[model samples]
Target: MRERVDKLKEEVCTLFTPSKDMLRRMYLVDEIVHLGIDHLFEKEIETALKDIHESEFASSNLYEVALRFRLLRERGFWVSPDVFQKFKGDDGNFLNELADDPRGLLSLYNAAHLFIHGELELEETISFARNHLESMIRDSVVKGPLADQVKRALRLPLPRTLKRVEMLHYMFEYDQDNGHNPVLLELAKMDFNLLQQVHLKELKEISSAILDDTYDVYAFSSIDECRTLNAAIQGWDDTAISLVPEYLRKFYEIMLSTFREFEDQMPSNKRYLVAFNKAEAAEWPHRNYKPSFSEQVALATETTGVRSLAAGVMLGMSDAATTREAFEWAVTSTDAIISCAKIGRFMNDISGYKVTVDVAIAKINELMEDEWKTTNRARIDNQAVIPVTQRLINLTMAIPLFYGYDSDGFTFGEQLREILENLYVKPMPI
Candidate 1:
């Protein structure tokens, strides 16, 4: 398998040679990323994209133009949204004739999603692309592979969707494309299966542990109960276990045992960073507090669990990749971490909350887009090692999969069952 992967990697890299057309190379780059094997060809991809960027590439085709724009911006290269002005007409709107090209519309739709603040061209472009693409789907003009791509993008654009879940979806779609490279497809399948086994093994290691909600189980009536519970967690010693109610003692003991297990594997100095103050996290809700929107966002940042998850992820990585400074950065409330937490919290709230007004939901969506821009900026500016940074990116991207647009995948397992099964249960056909 290792030898096969090496040969496949070499073949894929060759496809990036200067002889390949810019459009085809960009398409291959997109496919490799969607297939979740871009990491294997980082140098090849960077070289290809760097050449593309430096070439002053331009195309009359909307699909080619939009694809170039998105791929460049996604790689932290700043290609202005102004490149799209050519597609518009005299009335300051996207030309109606462009609607005939469903493929281009879909590409533009996906590209527009990468827009940051005040890029009204992309804002307009997205609205234009969406209306036309939905019309195409309604009219049944796009079929097969194209239709599948359209419908999926409409449901959730590529930028916001979870990487692993999107990879599975794209694998099936890529298989249907007549132009699909057999080597790339085979490599993707083998790589996915190999990683799936590793993930399944990790899952089996902790399969027996089931945690019940401590607050719900205790039915604590007052803030004092929460405070007492929090105090016990802070002590992190056997004597502290006696502070909580007798009924809660067993649960507390089990929790401490788990924390200690984690501590055992982690460096002693780093163990102090792995705190989980569930009791304090629930204080706002226990008091029935109705904070202003800003206050709510602030509160959500600390309680979203992203900070703890980030710390855990960093600690689990190699000490070389996760330096002491990197760990400190993870624990601190940096803009990147804060944006990720806000994105996750807002996504979860939007999924579960029963908001009657469309405007209110729109506001939340707008906030999420803003947070994404902040995240994108942070991604470009981050100084951490590539592995550590990619893990953080994966954590941020997984938020949407956890709490989907219409349903909370975390609270309701049904929505995520198929995705989880694809990742852990179903074997990729080799």
Candidate 2:
């Protein structure tokens, strides 16, 4: 399997040679990404994209242009959305000829999602392309991989969809493509199965969040019990465990023991940062605390679990660059971290039934878009470690998978059961 994977990877790299046409290269890159094997060829992919960028890529064909724009923008290149202006007719609308091509419209529709703030051209592009793509699907104008892709994009475009979740979908669709590369397909399946084994092994060691469940589900009748538990966590000692309710004693032990295990594995001086299990008990006193939208967002940002999870992820990193500074960056309330938390919280509120705000769903969605822009800007501006930055980005991207498109896949596991099965329980057929 290893020899096959290595040979397949070399063949995949050969596809990026300068002799390949720009459109063909772009499509291969997109497939590599969607197939979840891009991580195996990051340097090769980067070199190819840089070469493409230096070539002053341009195209009269709508599909080629849109694909180029999306591919460039997705990699932090500042490709202007105005590149699409040529496709508009004299009346300030997209050309009727463009609408007739569902393939090109689908490309443009998915590309528009990478828009930053005030890019009205891209926004208009979304509306124009979406209408045509939807019409095409309804009219059965597209079939095979394009058909499957357009339907999925209409639900959640490539940018927002989780990579792991999309891997199996793309693998199956790519299998149906007459032009698909056999080497790439084989590599994707092998890589996927290898990763699944690692994930399943790791899943065995991960216990449920007893403390969070205690606070959220197993509510205490006495508010003082909540206070005691919070204080006990702050104390970070087994002695404080006795002060909490009897049922919570085991949770505290598990949490403290877990942190102690983490501390033992780290440098002695840095062990202090391991006790980052702070929880707020103030909300317990007022169960009916109906906060305004702003208040809800602020509270949720703190309680959304991204900060601790990000920090924990950084702490566990074996990278030499994951230094104390990187750990500090993860725990700090930077714009990037705050945006991630807000995105998670807002998505959860929008999808779950626990929403306390009366704001319209559209309004919350708009706020999420603004937050996404902030996060994307932070991705460009932040000078943190590359591994840390990538980790934060991964954390943010995974949020949409669990709480995306007005569906709380986390809470209502049925929606994601098939996805999880594909990811963890089942391996791609060789």
lDDT of 2: 0.75
Quantify all predictions' global Cα lDDT against the true fold. Answer: 0.77, 0.75
lDDT for each residue of candidate 1 in 278-330, tens digit (9 for 90 to 100): 45445657667656888768766765667656767775566677776777676
> Where does candidate 2 stray beyond 4 Å?
18-20, 208-210, 218-220, 259-290, 315-329, 354-359, 382-387
* Candidate 1 whole-model C-alpha lDDT, 0 to 1: 0.77
lDDT of 2 at 58: 58
Over the stretch 1-430, how does candidate 2's per-residue lDDT look in tens digits?
8788888888888787775476777888888998999888777777777777777665888888888887776676667777888988788888888878988888888888888778878777888888888888999999888899899999988776777777878899899889988888999999999889989999998775444435555334655666677778767787887787887787778887777755544445443332232234245335765557676577667666666676777756666758878776776778878888888877776777656566677788788888877666654455446557667877888887877775778777886788888899988899
TM-score of 2: 0.87
Indicate which candidate wins on TM-score: 2
Q: Which regions of candidate 1 are displaced past 4 Å?
A: 18-20, 207-225, 244-281, 284-289, 315-329, 383-387
Query: What TM-score against the true fold does each predicted structure earn?
Result: 0.86, 0.87
